[model samples]
Target: MKKAAMTIALLIAVVATAGIVTGGFSYDPAAAQAAARIKVYSAEMRNYFMSDEIVKSKEEWRKILTQEQYHVLREKGTERAFTGKYATTHDHGIYRCAGCGLDLFRSEDKFESGTGWPSFTQPIAKENVKTEVDRSFFST
Candidate 1:
């Protein structure tokens, strides 16, 4: 009876351990894989910027991002005078596009240029951004 009870107890422990290792624990394999896939190019590139995985059709983005963000990202819409959030924030993190999750600037690169819009001396990479001339009558 004693030997039988010990064997039963051992089996229970093994099953419990297996359960914890698999289903009962909160281990997210997908997040782990994403973390593992992140590649750091330089000390300046420590922060990871992930693009939008949703792959929204052009029409979908037109429906999703605000008019301003879409204009800035899709149509190169510059923010109005003195109204950008990043202009005043002191938080230490990467500033990403709310529309596409593209890394725009690092908090460390931010500076006060007295312009209403947030100004950064530099971005993480030049290849990450595309710029075009805006010849709106509003600027004139």
Candidate 2:
């Protein structure tokens, strides 16, 4: 059964990679692969997607970040409990700051805190990690 499942998964992967369209949904291999690979282990590139210390005006940031992103990363807004896409994700890769692409957390350090938040016990780098008191509506 395992072998058969693996074979089916392999076939699906090939079909998806070939950019198949099924039931009004089109598969983009490049985009799918890119999304899957966003979890980086270490920084190896000089300039990727954006440069380090990306300083932009509020207007520019409003133009760049999505509504949810602008609210969360910019205003330090918190999503409702159990509503974030990554809250329960268990992927093995780096968790980067959506606003600055700063490497934040590692997959191995993720744990279920019963608070419906993505909690990490270990940050990959101390230099990149800083803590500030969250004085938001949900600050504890």
Each model's total of backbone clashes: 3, 0
Per-candidate Cα RMSD to the true structure, in Å, reads 18.9, 19.5
- lDDT scores for all predictions? 0.71, 0.74
Shift of residue 96 alpha carbon in model 2, Å: 0.8
TM-score, every prediction: 0.53, 0.59
Q: Which stretches of candidate 2 lie over 4 Å from their true place?
A: 1-52, 135-140
- Candidate 1 wrong stretches, greater than 4 Å: 1-56, 133-140
lDDT of 1: 0.71
Q: For model 2, how does the per-residue alpha-carbon lDDT over 34-130 read when each residue is reduced to its tens digit?
A: 5544332344452234223456899998997899899987877878888898899998988888777787787999999999989989777665566
Q: What is the lDDT of residue 25 in candidate 2?
A: 64
Q: lDDT per residue, candidate 1, 75-106, as tens digits?
A: 75578777776668889988776875667677
Backbone clash pairs for candidate 1 read 71-77, 72-77, 82-116
